[model samples]
Target: MAQQLDLVDFIAGLPMPAATAPQLNPLDLLPRRPKAWERLVAHVPAEDVRISVSPTWTRVVVEQLREDGCGDQLLGNGKIRSHDVPPDLIWPEPCRLILMTADSAARIHERWCLEEAPGAGMSSTFRFAQQQHADRTPVSQQLRLLAEEQS
Candidate 1:
C-alpha cells in the first residue's frame, strides 16, 4: 500500500502538458518574393544541358566547337531559349546549355546526379588537354584565319 501511494504521489507531482504555439504557414515568414530569373534558374529542360567550366577552358571549348562547325549553335551565356537553339540540330542524350559558371555548374551537377543522367552533361575541365599543346602560330595569323573562316 505504501509503495502504491508513492507511485500515485509521483504521478500527481508531474505537471500537465501545455499546448504548443499555433502553427503558422511557412510562407508567412518570407522577406521577399523571388525574381523571375531566380525562379527560372532552378529549373532546366531535360533536352537542354549546362556546361560549367573555368573561363580558360571555356574559350578552348568554344574554339573547339567553332572548329567543329558548331559555332552558330553556341549562344552567349543564358538559359537556353527556344529561339536560341538551332532548329536543324538534334541533341543526343544529355546536351548541355553553354557557358555555366562554376557555381551554377555545381548546382547542375547535383541536380543531374540525383536524376542519374550523368551523360546529359559536359564540363570544360575535361578538355583542358587542348591547352597543353604549344601552338607556334602567331596571334595575328590566328586572327586572320578566324576572320577568313567567319567569311
Candidate 2:
C-alpha cells in the first residue's frame, strides 16, 4: 500500500511563485500640473511690481514707478529664468516672497550701482529665486514646471 500524503505536506510541496518587482508606468514618473487657481501671485510694494513666482520660472512686472515725478509709467517687466526642483522640496510662500524681494532688490541695486559707479559688480543675494512659490501654490504645479523644464 502507498503512504497517503497529508494536506500540509501536499501544500508544502507546491513551488512558490517568483517574486518580481512591480513595474512602474512611464506616465507615473511624469510630473503633475497644478490648477490655475493654485498658482501663486504676489505684489511687491517696494517696487510696485507683481510677480508670479514658481519653482520653474518667475514673472516680474512693474506696473508703475515714480521716477523724478513720473506717473503711471512702466518701470520694467521681464521673466527670470530658472531650473526646476521637486515640488516637495520647494520653499514656502513667505520664504519665496522674501527671496524674490531680495533678488529684485539686488537687481535694482546692481543697476543703480552700474549707473552710479561703472565697473561696480553686484551679485544677487538669493540665487534660488525660482525654487520658491507662494504657500497656496500646489506641489503638482511645481512638479509640472520641473517636467516642462526637463522636456
Candidate 3:
C-alpha cells in the first residue's frame, strides 16, 4: 500500500542517534542548597565525633593558634574563639558545648566556640561548609565535580 511505503520511507529518513556524553556523578558538585544538618554531618569527623577549632586561617597565624592550644581547628578562614569551651561542641560527650556570640567585624560575622579537646582539630573547611549549608549554599560541592571532570 502507498501508506505502507510512506511509513517505511519516513522510518528510513530518520537519522541515527548521536554518541552520548559521559555520565556525570551527582556527588561531584554538592547542591547549591542542601539541608544544614547534612553539611554539619559531612564536616564532623566520623571516627572521633569532634570538631577541632582554629582562631584564624593563615599559615603563620594558624601555627600560632596551634601553639596556643586553641589550634585544633582545621584548614580554612575561621578564627576559633572560646577560651573556656569544653570538648564536643560539635558532638557532645561531656556536653562541652561551644560558646558563641553573634559577633561581626567589618567584613565578617562569626559564631564562636571555645574548646580544649587536648589534641583534636576541627576541620575549618567543614566549618566553612557548615556556614554555607546554614545559608543554603552548596557551592563547595563544585570542587568534587570539577575534579571529576578534569580527571
Candidate 4:
C-alpha cells in the first residue's frame, strides 16, 4: 500500500486539541481585560518563513504553516507538517515566549510553550520546541518587529 491518509476525517475526529500540557503566561482570554490569546502552542518544521510577500513564491513550503487549515494539511510531495518555535525560551521570566530559529538565517523555527495554566498552579512550560513543533510562518511574520535584526 502507498501509505494512504484520510485527513478530512482526521481533523473532524480531532477533539478540539486540549491544553495537553500546562500554561505559563496564561493571559486571561477576556478581550476587554487583556488582548492576549490563549494559544495552545505545539511544534513542527519551521516556525516562521521570513518572506517579503509582494512577490509570492509558490513553491515555498514555509508560508503554509500560518494558514488556518494548515494543521494536518499535505504539500505537493504529500507530506503533512507544521513549524516549531525557537530557543531563548529557557532563562527566567521577562519574555517567556522563547523563539528559536531552525536555521542560521533565522527564517523558520521550532517551539517551546510558556503560558498560564488554569488551576494547575502559577504557570509552566511544556518545552514543545525541544519536544515537537507548533506552527509555521515567515521570518517577517514570526519575528514581527525584529526583521531588521535578521537583515
Candidate 5:
C-alpha cells in the first residue's frame, strides 16, 4: 500500500502571491523632459522650425510625447515610431526633424536634425539643379535661417 501524499509538500508546491505589489515609480508619472529640448529651444524655438507633418511624422513637445506614450521610443533610440503618431497631426511639405537628448537636470532640449540620402552630394549637377529652383527652399537654407535667427 502507498503512503498518503504529504499535505505540507502539496501546499509548498502551490503558487503563492508576492508579499507586496510592485511599487509604481513616482518619476515615471512626471512629465518627461529630455535635455535636447532645451538646447533646441535655445538654438531654435518651435516657431523657427517648420514642421511638415505626415501620418507617420509630427512635431510634438516632450510633454505631449510622454502623455501620448512616446517617451520610450523617443528616449530609447531617438526615433519616433511612425504608427504611434497621433492621427490628428496634419501632414504638410518640408518636414523638419528634431533630435532629443537628456541633460543632468532631466530637462529636455530639441535641436534640428536631418537625414541625407547616401551619395546625395556626389554630383555637382544635382546641386546646381537644386540651386536653380527658386520656388523651393532647400533644407540647408532653412537650417541656416534657424542658425541666423538664433544669433
Candidate 6:
C-alpha cells in the first residue's frame, strides 16, 4: 500500500503569509543618486557644470571655463559622462533633480522591467502613482535650487 500523507503536516510545511501587505510607493522605484556625488560636484566649477538626472542615469557635463585665444578651443564644449544609478543608493537631496518627462519615466519603467525577472513588469497602480508624482513636482526648478544650495 502507498504511504498516506497527513493534511495537517502538509499545511504546516507551507509558508505563512504576512498579516498585512506592505504599501508600495512608485517614487520608491526611481533610481538612486550615485555615490560620492557631493565630492564630485564640489570639485567642479559650479557655473560650468550642468547635471541632469533621469530614471536610468545621471549625466554630468563640465564645460570649459575659458576659450583658447588661438580659436582652437571648442565652443560650448566640455566633458560629458553618464553615471548609472544603482538600486541601493539613497534618495532625496541630490536626487531632487529628476527628469519628469514621459520619455524619461518610460525609460525608467523599462529599466525596472529589465532588472526584474522576465515577464515581471511594474504594476499599473505604481505607474499611475509615478505619473502623479511627475505631474505635481517641479523637478527642473528643484534642480536649480539644489545647484544653488550646493554652490
Clash totals, every prediction: 3, 0, 14, 31, 18, 0
Model 1, 64-143: lDDT tens digits are 12112232232233322233334443332333334434443333332232111232233332111112222423422433
Residue 61 in candidate 6, Cα distance off native in Å: 7.8
In order of appearance, the predictions have TM-scores of 0.24, 0.22, 0.17, 0.17, 0.20, 0.23
Compose the digit string of candidate 2's lDDT tens values, residues 1-151: 9999999999999999999856433222111223221132222122222222223333242322222222222222432223433344322122222213333333333322111111111211221112122232333343344345434
Instruction: Output candidate 3 Cα RMSD.
Output: 15.2
Error of 4 at 17 (Å): 26
Worst 10 residues of 4 by lDDT: 29-38
Q: What lDDT is reached at residue 65 by model 6?
A: 17
TM-score of 6: 0.23
Ten-residue region with minimum lDDT total, candidate 3: 100-109
- List residue ranges in candidate 1 displaced over 4 A: 1-52, 55-96, 114-151
Summarize candidate 5's per-residue lDDT along 10-129 as a digit string, tens digits: 999999987874543322322344566433333422322322212222224322222242222333434433334454443222222233221211121111222222121211111111
Indicate whether candidate 1 or candidate 6 has the larger TM-score: 1
Ranking by lDDT: 1, 6, 5, 3, 2, 4
Model 6 ranges with Cα > 4 A deviation: 1-5, 9-21, 37-95, 107-151
lDDT of each: 0.33, 0.29, 0.29, 0.29, 0.31, 0.33
lDDT of 6 by residue, 1-116 (tens): 99888999989999998787454444345544344433333343322221232233223321111211111111123322444444443321121223333344445444332111
| Least well predicted 10-residue stretch by lDDT in candidate 1 | 125-134
- Model 3, span 68-104: residue lDDT tens: 2232332223443334334434333321112211121
Q: Which runs of model 4 end up more than 4 angstroms from their true locations?
A: 1-131, 138-140
- Model 3 gets an lDDT of 0.29
**Cα RMSDs of all predictions?**
16.5, 19.2, 15.2, 21.1, 18.5, 16.3
Best by TM-score: 1
